[model samples]
Target: MDGISHITFIVRDLDRMAEFLCKGLGAKEAYDSAGNNYSLSREKFFVLGGIWLAAMEGDPPAERSYQHVAFAVSQSDLPAYQANLQALGVEILAPRGRVQGEGESLYFHDFDNHLFELHAGTLEQRLGRYGMGR
Candidate 1:
């Protein structure tokens, strides 16, 4: 495959997820099914950082886990994302320990039990830091 075409999330409330995407994560709504089932069920689409993200109506996972999708973010904007997610009442997960130069990360769970991470580092940086085995 070339790369990720899109990421689809199974959510319960489209409106709520929309708010979380648009307001919390700075995503732009590309489409909304509006109760029209063109595919498997009702769905909505959003463009987040030039990536197509789909939110489909369905039963979310029953348990919360460490499984998550991470997005690249600048260090300066990390605090703003944290504040916005907190203001929206989203559950913020404690960040894991990290060595210097690996960069910062913010972890949180959405209403549908989907965990997300906003990371401020690139793979090269992470590998470089890890190479020292500190």
Candidate 2:
């Protein structure tokens, strides 16, 4: 099946953004080149979920071009993750609850104004619900 191997985003501060996704979101720093790019993960699989948050060394444009990125998380660990985010003063877009018929999801923005949706359920589940199963 074709699944997302990773998602990358541009940030204003590489270190701060990396830390937030690594520590607050439980994603481990998978790789770094000492430049401006970094990869983080909690597992190793071809269809697995991974992320890359990066920032250019020079000055960025007046306005960023992207909106946000949403990550998937299990419902069981959400409370703990929420607490960690709260401790860091991270703003949440939605409280812990079901989103209409979309199961459970928590929305938030990263340091680069990129929004993220942490959802529950497996890749198959997501595909089935969203018509990606075909």
Candidate 3:
């Protein structure tokens, strides 16, 4: 209870969303309820790097937004992830480039219109980039 255990996002199609997360982000399907809600996780254990991507049914249709979230990844993994995403027919931001300071990073958006960023740097290095460290 010290921190957020999981996050849930409402999506229009469970199957499609699941596929997107699995293939595009390397998330594994952990569970799915009969109600069409599913969860994806990086590993079986819940640790500092453990993350869960849950998709639930939504109404009023799904719309794209500028709002986005980011995830950390190895710099070496960025190109492959981008390639995988492109293979899945996902739209990526143009002029894709990397920012280096504490660590290198790449930014892109997902099918659900969520912006996600991948960073390749240590915690301290990343924190310093945003002046989080002094």
Best by TM-score: 1
TM-score of each: 0.95, 0.63, 0.72
Superposed Cα RMSD, model 1:
2.1
Clash total of candidate 1: 0
lDDT winner between 2 and 3, please give it: 3
TM-score result, candidate 1 = 0.95
Local lDDT at 89 for model 3: 90
TM-score, prediction 2: 0.63
Tell me model 1's lDDT, rounded to 2 decimals. 0.93
Q: For model 3, where is the 10-residue window of minimal lDDT?
A: 39-48
Instruction: Go through the candidates in order and give the clash count of each.
Output: 0, 5, 1
lDDT of each: 0.93, 0.60, 0.65
lDDT tens per residue, model 1, 1-134: 88999999999999999999999999999998886789988999999998999999999998889999999999999999999989999978888989999999999999999999999998888888888432
Off by over 4 Å in 1: 132-134
lDDT of 3 by residue, 50-71 (tens): 7766667564135656565567
Comparing 1 and 3 by TM-score, which wins? Answer: 1
User: In model 2, where is the ten-residue run with the lowest total lDDT?
Assistant: 39-48
Model 3 collision count: 1
RMSD of each: 2.1, 6.3, 5.2
Write the residue-wise lDDT of candidate 2 on 15-132 in tens digits: 6766677667776665555633343422221122554443333333445333555567778878888888777778876455442445576777766666667776666766677777
